[model samples]
Target: MSVNVITYDVGTTGIKTCIFEISDTIKLITAAVEGYQLYIEENGGAEQDLKEIWNAMCSTTIKVIDNSKISPGSIQGISFCSQMQGLVLVDKNGEPVRRLMSYMDQRARRELKEGMGNGLKISGVNFLKLLKSIKITGAVAASVKDPVWKYNWVKRNEPENFKRVHKWLDVKEYLIFKCTGNFIMTKDSAFGTMLFDIRKGKNCFSSKMCKLLGVNMEHLPQIAGCSDKVGLLTEKAAVQLHLKAGTPVFGGGGDASLIGVGAGAVSMGSTHIYSGTSGWVSTVVNKRVLDITSMIASIIGADDNSYNYFAELETAGKCLEWVKNHLALDEINIYLQKICVSDSLESLYVNLYDFMLEEIKNIPAGSHGVIFTPWLHGNRCPFEDSLARGMFFNISLETGKRDLIHAVMEGICYHLRWQLEAQRKKIKTSKAIRFVGGGALSPLTCQTMSDILGCEIETVDSPQNAGALGAAVIVAVGLGILERMEDADKLIKVKEVYVPNTANKEIHDRNFIVFKSLYKNNKRAFRIINK
Candidate 1:
């Protein structure tokens, strides 16, 4: 018998809610997406209104259920796979005391410097603090953007809001509270906070680490495994979402842990690369691998026994979105007007990205010496620099619009290659990496990425919905429809593979060497201008 489950893949800008029928095979019945705005401040702050986020999820859930025509009682459960490391401080009533501090927010530099960058230091972190943190939590809070720093920023800046904080939660955990009226953080989300002790906690939050970090232990929620049942959907949430009140709610995990399961990259050493609003390269490992220098930390994934060595890009396909709004306005409006195509203006807006890729398909491999950085919203992984901004380098009068556009795509591929290089230093990556995301839908991206990384790239079916699929897999395990996460590998198969293009290797390699130097060469300039 088939059981229906709804999974929410909540991202930085939006929530994608998908309903799937799980039985002999996992099949997507219907899906709906709703977007919310991320508020940016001049002082390097990025936030989102709490009510806006919850409304998006509610609307999308209702839309998905209504579109699927699935009965409220037929839906068995709900789970989530969302962006990690965001700070959502809630009061006892589960209401936010302040706007959400996005993972992209870096306004905590002062707090980070005072808290972890005092007296003596080793590799940008105070030695004693790093040692104590590493001993207890297997990682240290070095980045100004870490949730701990944001917490400190709140305590110091917004003292009134800080006083009412009943529990600190990640993005998805906050949403889960709305659905089930339970206060719990999944293991992966807790680990993202750099407060959970991997050595001794078992599943408990470590008081030693919490004390060392100067955190309020009273605020930390109980940790839950990804497959554990969180609670049943409450009547209030049920009315809002048009779902059954008693439906089960599972402990859904962060995107870094669950997307690999969706991509069928759950085996040891199996690597999967994702590009969405943000991007990441995660490989499942039997043992933990933490390289503070590279900023690639192995996370406790869905299964208790394993880890995901994860590297991230703060902005990925978001660069393409930037291009659509800023760079390609003329082509989309005037060119479409000239073509006088049968597709409506709304349809044209939906297909504009396809139009951009098709126009740049014939551009040369190297983009004729033009290079564009994909740091529109700063950067993470390999390097974490919030001051960094996107730029077009080596542009000449001869550089046309198409060449500049193609170079942006090439730059994104180059960064992914750089991340893979950094990760390869610590662990053995898969021979051929599975690529899943909205970026995977582009054949040009798949081919270019394979050539740039000098490895094979495989795309799974419905690559854009991989996170939703991953959350559905977790719900299936919780519902007893699947025995374990590994079983998902049998059901999700690769749809197509792109081999490295030998002819384009030299140019790509040459551009990548230049790409690596751009950030290093302009580090001081970035801080001076943006700071």
Candidate 2:
């Protein structure tokens, strides 16, 4: 029998609720998104209101169910995957004690330095600390974004609130608690905390590491496997979400881990690239691995027995949004006024993204020698530099607005290429990489990435919903509807394939060389400028 499931993808920018029909193939019946604000401050503060996030999740779930015209009783399971490394503290009542510190937040830099001391910094942990972390956890990032640092930030800065905390939950665990009334953390989510022993034979929270961070063991949530059935949806949560009471709720995973499963990259060496508000390239691997120099490491995969080697980029499609808000004044004014100049103009404003994609199509490759660096937010992988800033290089008098736009898109691809090479150093990535995220919506960008990487790229249906689909697949596996996570390979349907354009190979290769050199030449200067 076929099963329908609701998979909530709680992302950095918003929450996307996707309803899937899991049968011979997984089909997205419908989806709805509700956005919430990330309270970002100039002093490296990025936070989200937990109450607002929960409300968005409830509302979007209802919207998706109503829009899909599906019966709530027909839904067999519900699960979730969310942005990783966020620190969410909750009291005994399972209510958030404070606004969440986002994975993007860097306010804990000072604390991270204190804990790890000054050494060759990669992922927050220094050389000595990283070796220790690798010996225990299989991965470690000492960045301010790591949950442990965020926890310390709270302990030092918000002691009153921290003292009231009953449990430490990542975004996914909080959502799971809301649905199932179970305070459980998935193994994949635990990986982001830098507190888990990610070693293949010992994937559990490390008590020694907790002591190192001066954290109480009781504050951590109970760890569960990704496919473990935590509990059933409580009657209270079901009423709010308009779903059937007692539906099985499975522990999903961290967004990066689930994205691999969602894109059917569960097999070893299979690779996938995701571009959302943030971006990453993840490959499934047989065992744990860590590359401190490249700032890439194997985090826990959705499959309990495996790992996902991932490289992160702080911004991807978000760069386009930056352009829309700052560079596209005319487009913004039209949007603000809601004025219709013509029927086509109305359509253009309504679907400005489609218009942008069409514009990108007309622009030729290489952006006529203009190169853009997509580091609007400091980079995370392939070299962790918080000071790196985005730039447009090799611009000339002949460069047009279209060239600038195309260059920005190309810049993101270049960053992805850099990340890919870093991961390639540790593992054998698949020749054909799967693409999933908002960026995959653009045929031009997909093709550009193919040419830039000199490899084949595959995008699947509703690519941006990969995280959601992966969550549902996890639920299915937990409920015995599917035999294993690998069954996802048969369920995922590819939308299109983009092959390398040999015609643009020479120019892109040259541009990539310049891209790598740009960073090496500017590292010291970046620190000076940002400092």
Candidate 3:
């Protein structure tokens, strides 16, 4: 009999669940979910209600199971793939002490500066520098201080909620606690908290950090790997989720690492590109390959042995959506239709994106003396400048919408290329790139990536749900249905490969040169504006 596996991706925007049949070959039976909204406040503070998030997860799980024809009794295990670095506080009775502090939340920025003293400069940037300075070593690091810093901020400010607090947990661990009545953290999720030491695969919190922040490490849950079974689902949780009691709950990793698995980018040389709300260029490394220049080495996989060098440029698809909503709302479908209408010829309809692409395509390899910096959401890897803003240099009235569009695309690709180039210096071999997420659906974008990166981009048959599928892979592995993760990888198939056109490569090369200089010229200007 085939084992039925259910996996959940607890994301910032919403909760997604997938049900898969695990036999000789893993098969996706059904996958669906509902979404939740994020609560944003003043000063770059973003948060989510834990109760609503958990309810959404449970509701989605129940919905998937209720809609499925397969019996729930056959489910062997359930696992999770969650957003990394969000902090949640709970009391002794397992009640929330405060609103969950999302990774995007910058309230900790003030605390980070105060804790770091005169050495700290800016808000977010200084926080990262202070994290590096502490040099905490472990697979996971729970900054008793950082969380407390944010927690105390809430206490001093909010007052009402702070007094009610008891224990603090990462979002993933908190979700597990809700389902299985267990408090545990995964290495992958823990590593992203800036509390963990990348050098050593352990959870080492510093006394100095603890003293400054006044947080006790004991309040944090024990840490484990993605494959490890955290606990069995309780009767209440099983009933609510429409699953059998005692189903194994596996500790899952961060979405990025699992995405690597979903894209079959698990082994060394395997590269995966996920372009959704944000865009990322990620590759798995057999060993830790740190890029001093880019700061791109992140532990992506559940296993401690491997690392994920991920570089991201925010607002790829989001930017396009912005354009569609603002500039070309009326002719959106017409533009989409034009993309498929002409296989042999260029599109006739001048959709905002197509118009942009055409101009970009015409502007030689590097946007023809035109350079665009895609710092729409600031920046993360390769350049961790929050003050960084978008720029277009060497522009003339001749620069059309097409030129601007292509510049945006090329600028994002340039950021990815910079990270990849850094990775190449550390890792001798890299594999063909696999494209996943909503952005992968765009043939033009895929081809453009190939043209710029000089590598074929392969996309899985189902790209949008790679993260959920990866969570399913974890369930399959935990249930002993698959002997190894690579077995799961083999069963996972790619739908198409977008090979790079040699002709377009030369054009992108010229544009890339100018793209690099745009940032150099505007870096000071960006800081000045921020100041």
Whose lDDT is greatest here? 1
- TM-score winner between candidates 1 and 3: 1
Better of 1 and 2 by lDDT: 1
Q: What are the per-model numbers of colliding residue pairs?
A: 0, 5, 14
Q: Model 3 TM-score?
A: 0.82
TM-score of each: 0.97, 0.95, 0.82
For residue 330, model 1's alpha carbon misses the true position, in angstroms, by 3.4
| Candidate 1 TM-score versus the reference | 0.97
Cα misplacement distance, residue 304 of candidate 3 (Å) = 2.8
lDDT of 1 at 48: 90
Candidate 3: residue 158 Cα off by (Å): 4.6
lDDT of 2: 0.85
- State the displacement of the C-alpha of residue 28, model 1, in Å, after optimal TM-score superposition: 0.4
Top-TM-score structure, candidate number: 1
Tens digits of lDDT, candidate 2, 1-531: 688899999998899999988887788899999999989878788899988899999999899888989999999888888898899999999988899999888877788778886768644556777678778987765566778888888999998998899999999899889998999998877778888876557767899888877778899888898888899999999999999998989888888888878887777789999999999888888877788778788877788667788889988888888876676447446454564357877666446666666766878778898888888868877877767889999988998878988888999999999999988887899999999988888888899999999999999987888899899889889888789898888888677999999999999999899988888899999989886
Off by over 4 Å in 1: 331-350
Q: lDDT for every model?
A: 0.89, 0.85, 0.68
